[model samples]
Target chain A: MVTYPGLPGPIICDYLSREASRGRYGPGVEFQIGKIEMVANTGTYLDSPFHRYAGGKDLSALPLDSLANLDTVVIRIGGGSVRAIPRAAFQDVPVQGRAVLVHTGWDAHWRTERYLSGNPFLTADAAEYLVSQDVRLVGIDSVNIDDIDDPARPVHSTLLGADVPIVEHMCRLNLLPDRDVRFFAVPAKVAGFGTWPVRAFGVVST
Target chain B: MVTYPGLPGPIICDYLSREASRGRYGPGVEFQIGKIEMVANTGTYLDSPFHRYAGGKDLSALPLDSLANLDTVVIRIGGGSVRAIPRAAFQDVPVQGRAVLVHTGWDAHWRTERYLSGNPFLTADAAEYLVSQDVRLVGIDSVNIDDIDDPARPVHSTLLGADVPIVEHMCRLNLLPDRDVRFFAVPAKVAGFGTWPVRAFGVVST
Candidate 1:
């Protein structure tokens, strides 16, 4: 997964005292407590409908069937000169009720200045087509599914408005097969939150 | 799930301009961004080996097999006067290579002050027995798996020292069957972090 640029990854600090704990307990018993500070959108994350619409469903309200144990499809857009993924790219795939992942191979530039500029993105037409096909979820291996330079954010607006969740900043899409895999990208069930980081992975049946 | 007392729940704040986005794009194009700040131990959370040992495996280091799609066993301990769960509580069940969940029915007091105090926890002997049995993971429907008053945190020390992950503050354990269930408690893959909140749930075959 591509680490979010400028976002503090994770801060681990001591919470309880090991010496004090050991002294209070036995010699072999030494416990340490830690505290972490992180932003909701720090790394590879999912954006629920509430991320785009104020009254839309938040992370807590999402159904588990939509996020976990999903049939998945991987669309490789790497080695292509076109940056904007168009509707034709998805016309041939069976996207209904599956996690459609667009692998742009842009994760190679993760954590670098190159990752921030000229990243691949899905066009508004592609987002509309995915919505029409009734995809369960959409994911991309890029900084954002929409062009960051475009303040309109048409891709996010089209997909999230239809209650289709989006996973961004994913890596290792190349590791997954082109079709027939189980996908999961569940986030912490935090109420009132629209977006948060997740442990996104695909499970292939051996 | 029991919400940790005094811990801040998710807060969703607006990030981008809805009016500007709509004006820039089409009429229905309005985007809303959110910011969230939460304590890692706020709700039902998983503790990696690093939670107790600084040099041990962090969240990112944990294997997927250890966290997802494991056969689970639920042991109900409600309506009993006992607070300290002993090793004998697990004597009758098949716990080896499974996710053992102790359902204390303490989730009834979730989000209440009663949930914080007088919660059920595992004894040190119980943790040792689970380790000996080679259980994949342990979960409980209580404020914590260890007695919070005991600064020693014997349960955490014993379990985490054995590299067995623990999921605390789980709820709805009663919903799961006594056997033949799939358990998942995946946390965000944040490096250098020992503990973080998770979307803990079980998949029961229909």
Candidate 2:
């Protein structure tokens, strides 16, 4: 489901096939019921605070205590042509409510076209210093943490205007470590919706 | 995003609006980039085994250790007129490799029409006794594990034909606590998608 170069990708067919559920579960009983349309920013997503506040908090007002398990902190910032990323690169982490994530290895230009143009963002003073250190999530292995020609996204308007929760097209993050990571990105609570697509994972302490 | 009565429900518009991002980020900067179309089994979901063996394994071959933070077990079964269930209601716990939820509190008839007529499931000899006790995942708080008027799903063809993964319409499970539960239902690794929709959570040890 990795398709986001101007969205609209993900149409996985079959709403009951396998020879049509073997004619409604006959033969040695069959099953399959896929169906999807998509464009909540295609892959690896997660963006609550109603995707930039309109009376914030959607995706069913987020809380499973701020997504699955949380309490993570990655930071690294390795990989070429350093683009922006200020606030003294998150001043040696201990980022408040944790789930900092920024390992910029831009997911090795995932699914090409150089991952939608020379990206690597986050710097309205690193989103106002991770929303003045009350972070509960903010991820990015690239592709828009703002600076897609800066349409004044200002790091998604200062970390979704402080209700936090971001997580972009992330990828491994060099196998997470640097703080007892344990994040998890859930979605599909959908109430008046505001950004979907997530299966983000993290959980290390090996 | 709770459709699935003949599918299609989730059209959440807005592909960058907030008065069109304040005419492209002018004013005190605005943002919103939503867009969704539905059907991946609408609301609560998960089921890999290519959704039922075509060559099995889908959702990008599911592993974040069998869908996030395992070791769970609820099995309460206490709703009215208990439908099916069996395998002696999971004969005194210790369900081999965890995640065997089934708290038929039928989610207090979730979004009504009695959550689609007569809803508790999981029989086929309790899905072949949790696929011969190798359960790594299998959830339910209602609305299907099998027995949606027996379309011969055979507990979803005997636990997704032994690749074992299935979570469906789950709700709190009467606030879980019958085992050190810590489940988490993830989805969106979509490869020919077999099912989607999830925000199913669980984690107890208070």
Candidate 3:
């Protein structure tokens, strides 16, 4: 039902399962699904402060309001040649106390080798600007909000250090209006776990 | 920042770890701190069909849409003394194709011994009525939507078997207006896993 124009269908990475050969519950079988088998961060994900800060709240300590019912505003910075979105891009949009979802439309490359290409991203200044605005959540339709190829990764540090949750690998932003939808990207609650996969989405009134 | 109005506060739990003694890379030491242990269903959680159905999509196969961006309407029953919500209670509510959030104010009992006793629940007929309305999601603020003591769990079957996700252990329904908010309850994508905790909340326009 989610149709994207000018893009291939959404790619859902098939979840792989490793048959238990031996484990504690007995030699017979033990299904250690999340912990042992998959990447701690995969699919759509939420990055918490623990991902960047030394003494930050793990997934368990993340406030429920941090991930739920956030007033969302999506900024459309399209036209193929966007390298990094600047603070000026958000000039008239309200950012305080809301989830700022940047619709880059880069998730169209999910799962394919192209997903890792030079996708649109937020500038370091833009991230600092968001934190200055007291944004609760920042989400992107790209591989990562930080330039993945960048060794410094300023976006992750600026945002996560402020305890602002970031959602990456999001699909279907094309279905959303630029400024009216509600965004949610809830991470798992584990004492020491900070970054983990999440099923993030937006709800708009009809 | 999430100050709960009453007793249990918010039963929504969180777990995030970075060092693990056990996992896929195997026992001794692993760099990735996976979620090694937690209640299968904890915090704000979801009850998928596989939680109760023998042949159903496990947590991994469940569609992302089932847990995301649901049009929600909270029906506030049990104003004072009423405990059981019957099918007739929802006759006037617009339930078709929406997430029906039943707020019983029982979230006030979370984490206390009192939470485990005499919880309000929906009747069997209420479950049938919801299915008839083709509801996308069903949620409640209690520990469980049905009387957990009831071995049959008709509400679980009728709703989950229809592939409708059920969110439990929510707090702060008192803060939301009945019909204007959108609810989101999302779970992790772990293949073959039946259930996991969730952070469910509603969005209201300011």
Candidate 4:
């Protein structure tokens, strides 16, 4: 449970321990039911429109196609020190109606002190570029898609404003190629809940 | 959030409310980061082997193939009055190597007083039958997949003992056909946790 530095990490506990369940089940049959308490932004999580706007769609309102089984495009930001990703990087690729994954390789710093400061983030101009291209969803391997120093979080506002879902804190972007990838990061379909963690994965079809 | 009876429902609050975020972000730009606290067996949740066996695989150890893009086989329990789903209902279906979703029409009682008792469940023999056939996963559109009166809970024991995951409290099974459906109900990749909610859906291939 990799929560942001200021927020609380996930607390996982056993509601019905296997040892305690022996009284409920047979001698050889026992089950352990767990309980979790955490903020929705912990670890790899997706944001629906409702995260940014009150009148926007929540997790239950999102259609399945918007979150699953779509052609993907990965944008690589090399040099390892580029903190502010600009719009120039997204100039001319077939990004319309695709899931764009920004591979910053910043995930190497996950759970470390290095991840807390001067992390890579997408600029507002880049977000404007993506919304202009009608991207279905945008994801990143970094902790927050927006620059924490900037108060507005323009990337999240711009993307979620156009009904484009965002997935943050993704891992294994290097495992994905530049093309022919299909990404999935569906949140639990709970009404009034706008953000939650997901088991984000991508499949490359050769 | 549809938690089981006698348990608390999900509490969804804002960790970062849109009203509060105005101080952080610019005017007209605000984000709402939600927080949730609930038992792992809430609505449409999946159980890993660790839910039943302490040494068994938890959510982090589950391979994606076990939860995604699985060829599905829906076994319809018609007549709307069958309380106990037997192995005979699963016979004559191409269930091997596929996700088996048992439709007992019990979801119609969801969120109602009727959903608490006398609901549908799979017999222990039915669980053994599917495990013998090497079923990849088993799901039910019911609150509990085992007879609550039966203290042993043999179905959960047998199926989870064989490393076959289970999905419960699923809805909308009546909308699915008998075959050519691909079911996906992936849990969050969390270590030390054995159960969690999922946005379960099916893609019917034409």
Q: lDDT of all predictions, in order shown?
A: 0.82, 0.79, 0.69, 0.88
Best by DockQ: 4
RMSD to true structure for each model, in Å: 2.9, 16.9, 9.2, 1.5
Better of 1 and 3 by TM-score: 1
Q: What is the TM-score of chain B alone in each candidate?
A: 0.91, 0.34, 0.81, 0.97
lDDT of 2 by residue, B1-206 (tens): 35445566667778677786687665677767777666667778888888778888888887878888888888887645788889988978899988788888777777787877688887899889888989988888777777777766788777887888898888867767888977888887878777788888776767
State interface RMSD in Å for all models: 3.1, 7.9, 10.3, 1.1
lDDT of 4 by residue, A91-159 (tens): 877888798999999889998988877879999999999999989999998878998777778998899
User: Which pairs clash (backbone N, Cα, C closer than 3 Å) in model 4?
Assistant: none
Sliding window of 10 residues with minimal summed lDDT for model 4 chain A: A1-10
* Model 4 / residue B46 / CA error / Å: 0.4
Give me the chain B TM-score of candidate 1: 0.91
Comparing 2 with 4 on TM-score, the higher-scoring candidate is 4
Give the lDDT of residue A89 in candidate 1.
88
**By DockQ, highest first, what's the ranking?**
4, 1, 2, 3
Fnat: each model in turn: 0.55, 0.80, 0.19, 0.91
Q: Quick one: best lDDT, which candidate?
A: 4
TM-score, ranked from best to worst: 4, 1, 3, 2
- Candidate 1 is scored at a TM of 0.90
TM-score of chain A of each: 0.91, 0.34, 0.80, 0.97
Q: Residue A183 CA error for candidate 3 (Å)? A: 2.8
